[model samples]
Target: MSKRKKHNLQWIKETLELKEDHNWKSQPGTRIFVAGRGALRFDVPQDWHFEPDTKSFRFLDKKPPNDDCRLEASFNLLPPGEWADFPLVHLLKQVVRDDERNPIEQGEIIRLKRQTARIVWTQFKFIDPQENREAYSRICIGLGSGVQCLITFDYWVDDAERLTPVWDTVMESLVLGLYIRDPRTGLAFPD
Candidate 1:
């Protein structure tokens, strides 16, 4: 058999890499997720596993692959100058739309901004006929440094009341950051 040559594509070369820090295990209260881009960092629980996309970090409350106890979060950095043109209402419309192009039952969109951070929280509820139970979720859009980051919490109606408190605690501890350049020095911040 002849040997085939190895080649790397531009996209493949720039793909993000996920790594678990040994230091996180040794430290008592510090947990961090570092993306290969050096521009993204997340303060995540030490036990959560990185998702395939590298943009999301997932933590399961019980055993593996159980949707009932999953928390999913992802970050997206918008292209330069795109934040100004980004419409929250438009994005929300798309997010809540189902396969039939219908909006799910949702509450009013609440918007808040603090310093450089702008956040939009949307509450949604729908009945999952297959599970014979209601489904609830909170979609959070946090904008900082022109980046829109999403943090979603989903659970069955049965566990909604019990998991409400749990989600609050987790959201409080979650931290997301994007690299910012020092205008004076024109240099990107170190990871």
Candidate 2:
């Protein structure tokens, strides 16, 4: 058999080379955190595993490939000079519609808008195919300046007593950055 070469795409190369400390990072605290890219300033439970990605990240509360206990966050940022053309609610609805499975129970959209940011979210219950058990999830989308962040938290219903607090902590502290840039130096800031 002949050996095949690995094809490295532009995005794959760029994403692979992104160092943790230089790009995204989590500062020490009671909960794990994702802080960078002007996308999020959010945290998860203290014991969860932190996994990184170019435009998204995941926090696993349990071992992978099975069971339902994890949180995922994805984001998009507009170019410095541009502003969002679609309303926040529009994006929020799309997220709900795009869920992998039809939910058994769905809560109303909870929305909060302020000068700093506007956030919309809801919780849903469904049967997770991989785990073959009832799963609870919350999807939150926030927009501010030219950045938008979407956070999804999924857990087993039986574990709500333990996981609910983790979800609350995340929503309470979620902060979307303005993504502003300094004229002299193009680096982002705030810890």
Candidate 1: RMSD to truth = 9.2
1-191 in candidate 2: lDDT tens per residue? 01123444344222234434443334455453534544566666677766565556778775555434778888776567644445766777777778777888988888876466788888999887755788888898888766678888888889899889888777877778734243123246542
TM-score of 2: 0.70
- Model 2: how far is 107 from its true place, Å? 0.3
Candidate 1 per-residue lDDT, tens place, 25-126, comes to: 213443544443323344444554434343465555444454365566667766667464467766865776642313257778877664455667676876
Number of clashes in model 2? 0
What's the residue-level lDDT of 139 in candidate 1? 75
- Candidate achieving the largest TM-score: 2
- Model 2 misses residue 22 by how many Å? 18
Flag clash pairs in model 2.
none
